[model samples]
Target: MQRQPIAEAVREDIVNGKELVFVDFDHTLLACNSSELFIAACKPSWLVACIDLVVRRLIPWKLTHVPHWYRLRDYACCALIVLLCPWNVMLWKRGAPDLFRRHESRELAVSLRACDPTRLVIVSFGLQWIIRALLSESSWRDTPLVATPNLAGPAYFSSGKLDIVRAHYPDEVIARAACISDSLDDQDILHAVGKGVLIEPQGDVYRAEEHLYLPLRYTAAAKYARSYVLDQFLFVDVLIVIAATSFGFSTLWQACLFVPPLMLSLMCVYELGYFENDMVAARKEVAPTLTAKVERYRTYPIGFGAWAWALVLGLLGVLLGWHFGALRSETLLVSAACWLAVLAVVRAVFFAYNGTATRWRAFFYPVLQLLKYGSPFVLILASLPGAVLVLSQIMLMWCSYLIYRAGGNNKAFNRDVLRLMMFGLGGVCLAASFRSAPVEGFFPYAITAAWACARVFKAPIMRACKTLRSRPARRSETAL
Candidate 1:
């Protein structure tokens, strides 16, 4: 009644030359719903949302039966998404269209290839250009497709599919033809055809009349893994770590010796954090990316694997650093022990207050990041390490501000700019003190004191800003 290889079903019951084979595009042939993936990839915009709502509400469900109306609606919807959405072109360039072609069923492809390309027709409500682009990548490039075009014309949807099929075949030939679809909406097409295959959303084919069930042989797990890893961008941090260490020391030898294991360990650490982020995303039911599925990140194999790999690689980096004379053995051992202790304490503190502590954790994360990325430099250059650390921290703060501003996070941008101003003012005062001091007379403690006082005052300013924000809220509550 139902089978794995579609070729077996086609050969056993049907005549490829005489009977036409109609395939539904979206969930039947492709692993994912192209429209869903496209919508997920697009950035949120109020204008686009309003347009989408208007279009959906105004377009009568009954109008799908009409040819020109359906075409116009399809064109309008596509244009609204492309023009009104803030990141429309970027979403497409990021391979929104390629999502359809990513996991084409090999067995289905084989079955379609076995049939006459002309007789095997793609009937879908999916946009024609996108479906054609997807098909062009596979052996089904020459296959005939009946789909919704970009311009106003006849478009296939619901019962319109049957009309397209009827136009392609004579009554005698249609009596021997077959239609394969994934939704109940296509039941009319199934009823009209002599034979029908009901493909479940998971891609197991069933005999429409017999109601047979078959096990699915394919899944998108591996594809999800590849896409998820690439999107996280762990390698960029590895490069930054290498550059930070090399720049700090102003020497390539120690950078070269320390970078390999350091890069590996840093990637593992970042990926461990990524696993945590993905776990939170899953718990929140926010699948922001194609691969943000619970099965992709939440299982013991994936979660445990990241932690174990990070620990092992971190230890390996320390050992390699000591062995290569990049760092002293005793120093590496002490640093490893302290690192473990610090991580345990941080985790305990972070979880103790639950969500309330998250803001503090976020603030400190970049500070800890600066220290971690600069650890190699600290080990190599004992002299002026403080100066290097201070300067790097100042640069990191400003760079983070620029990034936050670009992303439109005004709150973070303002906070980071305040921090940068404090650092800049302190640096100028310290430098002035050093310059003003007599060459023969050697007291720079006064300058250092001024710099320390400037840093200490920064906390009060931050607290004042927080207090100011709360004052308005407090007044409103009192009035209520």
Candidate 2:
């Protein structure tokens, strides 16, 4: 979505394989409005108020940081965020049914990965957790992520964002190429880049003072995106493929007696590798010092060991069927269900370790985690983290997701999601313990009830949550 001369300039750098800085998220790089869609998914009420405030000029991006504007920002933001909305769910994913209505805003992330992977870099201002999680699974992982740090107290990172960039990379330095935002808030960071491009929306104009103004006609950009992919886009296509293939295989196997279930389970687990949603990437801004650190840890192994586990599961599933009651439709279904539970466990471990959380997603996440863990681990084969993981997942789905549908707060990972996930874990145990059909059906329900009870019993917002909060710490501005 980089308009006119800026797009042409950046594209030239990308094609030439010259070093360049790519700074954009929404419209310019991404095709969808990631932020608005995410906010709509959870906190629909707050979405309108925030956007309306921006339109009404109740809050302004601080170019000069006038006292009134700061005060207005504080008040408007406070009132708008009566409750903090978690950014974890806002990821740039590849596959999921698009039955839901999508939203549009200035937030875009996928565009960066799609347009140019080699020379392009992300320069955005999204939260670090959301940004990192999205980029970890991205083709753009090779590129650096230089974004505005989180601002949630010592536990969060914010303020001195541009200052930190400058201390690392001085303005006098020449970058191969650069793109800057038109937001007055981006002036400092923009000025630091070599060839800053100003992104002015329709009807908004700024008189140039320090840099050249790059006017991108909005209508032209939109028209271009209709036929062509944006520069940084990465997902959506692959996700559609994943969803279609999985759904198709599931339906095809619906009538089959043995292999279909395992195939479906494999696909579900495979989906875990596709990460969460996101809007923008961190701003690289043509600063090597800034870009270097961001690139180092961008790609975290997604669904860590999904493929290996799926293979092992397939082998075991075939072996079990061939040796025992291979023809039993019930056996295949149960095995598939068990694998589903395993996939959920895999995701649970990811959430525990990486702090990744997705609403309703946690239901299926645990088994995925278990599959990944139990696949290569000889220890799991011996004791069956496989069984334990599956039981735990079912316990959670029946107990947590089905029971306490509206309870967990994602904005802050409290004990609710924990207890809910545990319900799944416990369900797995209970189901395994009881072989009877009546008990199996009831166990999930019972687990759901327990999760709900726990949710109701515990403090809605577990004040003492977040391990990072316990120790007093200081982050020097020079932190990468």
Candidate 3:
């Protein structure tokens, strides 16, 4: 029998009032079978392999000769053996290069995301724990899955899939639903549905028929460039760099000469830091919460090598800028070294206290943000001819204004406003003081004064805002 295309099968089912779509897990929705990956993660043992071999051999004989509903003893035995292994050992092995590879079919994941979650079901003979773990971060996290349980019952393959379907839906509903699978063993469930879609091993769509044949169209999202430019925050970094250059009163020529190399160097440096952080977290037996998508699997040694490459690229960019006379090479080197030293100290502190209290972490959060978002521009200004010294103060004022606008709570907003007001006054003082003293002499004074004002009035300003907001609410309640 010639198989129809997947799109045609799906349309027929939907037209027939079938809302539910049952998809097989292994080669159907995922790039590879997760069970195989799990087995491969374990240390090779001929004894274990032979045991699994016996189990596989017995599965068919027992299922065919015994009652269809009879418990799959061999399958249960295999699952117990696999799941009982030490989780730590398995995780360590999983980190090995190319040892256990499992990637989902992005095309299928996107296609299913378009459908209602409640209308999707995953039925497979693979281990349920492995399947669930893999889907934890995916769009299908909450979708219903009926696979071979860790320990129990008949295997969820062939006739077993139909059995599970009947348990979940009415006979009429099952008749209207569509089941998608690649294995010929899925024939029983496929025939039970209104329409069926058979996917080839290479992810091509095919008609649900006896033999797999022919190629179809391929679809995949742009992964590499998108991951860096958008997902890794490089786009926002470029915008910030350009905006700062404009604000610093730099000419268009200067901006054109410096922006690309500056952006490239910063992007590489920041990504290197993130890669190193992730590897450190992984080694500490903690999965990193904040990691770049591209550096998800990077190990510490790999990250170190990448960081070295980034340093080289950044140095090359600096050399080119110096050759163009856009910056003083000696000043740039000194300033960058100072900034890098500061960053290294912060990172060392962070790693030393990897599991510090939330309050302590929160205290350092603003400082970290300033380092990550503001340091590059400051270092660049040190080498280039810009009012960088003065503009740094103005940048603080602008950032405070932005914070005021975005502060969710009224008290926070008022506090931010007060900080901005202090910044404005400090800027005025600096402009006046610059005439009497050198910029170097007055710059420290302005920063010191601004810091003193914020420290002194921070609590009082926040308290006043809170009191003001409460008065109106209290008055409304009194009137009621």
Candidate 4:
């Protein structure tokens, strides 16, 4: 039976000659899926445990063969509803008001309220009872809704929804109507309507605009580029190159002249490795776990532009090095050949690492890190002290990686372990200085010790001072 206000509104809309507007309920009017929320609210302990087991244990094995686990999960939830219809209905009725208030998209709700109530209709694949119960206490109580009739029946989704709309209104009405939805599944209905408005998810908010249905690759190019370039910063590599040059050359002018081009070349190599690794991961279907940022990264398409840019930067670095006397005529050919060989080896290792499955990928990570950190040594082959410094730094980093992995990969724990390792390396370098050139050895010790102490103790000292300050405030409050 049609409510009086909805019937009256429809009659008035027809009289006023306004076209009907259709909006999807889930992820459009609401910020979350209503069916998932219903299942979460009403599922018993046994059902919850079963679902958890399937997700954690069974799903992983099936992921390689069946990527559509979400559809299966939805079917399971619908099956539960059919199995325990009476209990679910009771639970939903009791919880509907609170759930609706918490999950309704306030911005969309406001926009929807501004529309002529008679011309606006809510359409969804969600069960009718659930939708009605959620909207019972809202201002939209009388809004006409076309939804799945029951859990056991076929969902009024996709073409079925179009058929139902056609039955309810004349052909002329649908031809002039507009649809708002977040799903591509509603493309048929969107085409049937005169206009389509898409609700695109951007971080925490949804942006609604005219639907152009752009391809994922084109829409997400900027996001993918940002992820590739900014995800892991290259400052540590910069510092390594600077430290190497300072230890290698006695004259400050020589160090200054050579470091810039060497650093540029190293950066180009790192960027090339990153680009190839990401491309291989994409082809092998080894995507990162689902998150908003990672999802954007996954959409990055293979392109020649990034490859061309990396090659250009590398060539520029080589030219600058030759012009600046870093690659003198006497040794230019040998040095360039060695550098090319090193580049080839690094690229091969990256391909191997990227092609490996996730289960065994960790084993390759340390090797990859070692090659990257050690590659700068090829440019500073003449300095024994610089070579020693670089070797010690690599050892410290490698030990830290081992400790980090052994400790279940907790980031805070890894940081503390790295600091302790740095302190030890500093002490070793300081003692070794007595046997070698004091200035060369002392430089590394000074850098490592100062950095380690500052990072490791800064947090504790600040916390102690904060506690002391808070005690005085608490004492004053007690006296009052």
Q: Give the alpha carbon lDDT tens digit for every residue of 1-480 in model 2.
A: 343443444344444544455555433443332233232233333243344345324434575454334433433343344345443244223211131112111233332333455556565544433345444544455576665444533211234335444444555542445654534555555565666665543221111110110111111122124222321111212111122122223322321333333443343343333221210111211221122222222332223334444545555654554444332344555555555565556545544433333344455544554453233221112112223333443443344443443565433544346544564566567558666653223333533344335553445444455445776788988999
lDDT of 4 by residue, 68-126 (tens): 34434455555555475558678788889787888787766765666678887898777
Q: Give the clashing pairs for model 4.
A: none
Which candidate achieves the best lDDT against the true structure?
4
| lDDT score, candidate 3 | 0.51
List, residue by residue over 188-238, the lDDT tens digit for candidate 3. Answer: 788888767776643433211101100000000111343444522433344
User: 2 or 4: which has the higher lDDT?
Assistant: 4
List ranges where model 3 is wrong by over 4 Å. 5-18, 44-77, 88-102, 155-158, 202-480
Full-model lDDT for every candidate: 0.51, 0.39, 0.51, 0.56
Task: Tell me the deviation in Å of residue 218 in model 1.
Answer: 28
Between 1 and 4, whose lDDT is larger?
Answer: 4
Question: Rank by TM-score, descending?
Answer: 4, 1, 3, 2
TM-score of each: 0.39, 0.29, 0.36, 0.43
- Segments in model 1 whose C-alpha atoms lie over 4 Å from true places: 1-11, 15-17, 41-76, 85-98, 152-160, 167-173, 203-480
Give the CA lDDT, 0 to 100, for residue 337 in model 1.
Answer: 65
Tell me the TM-score of model 1. 0.39
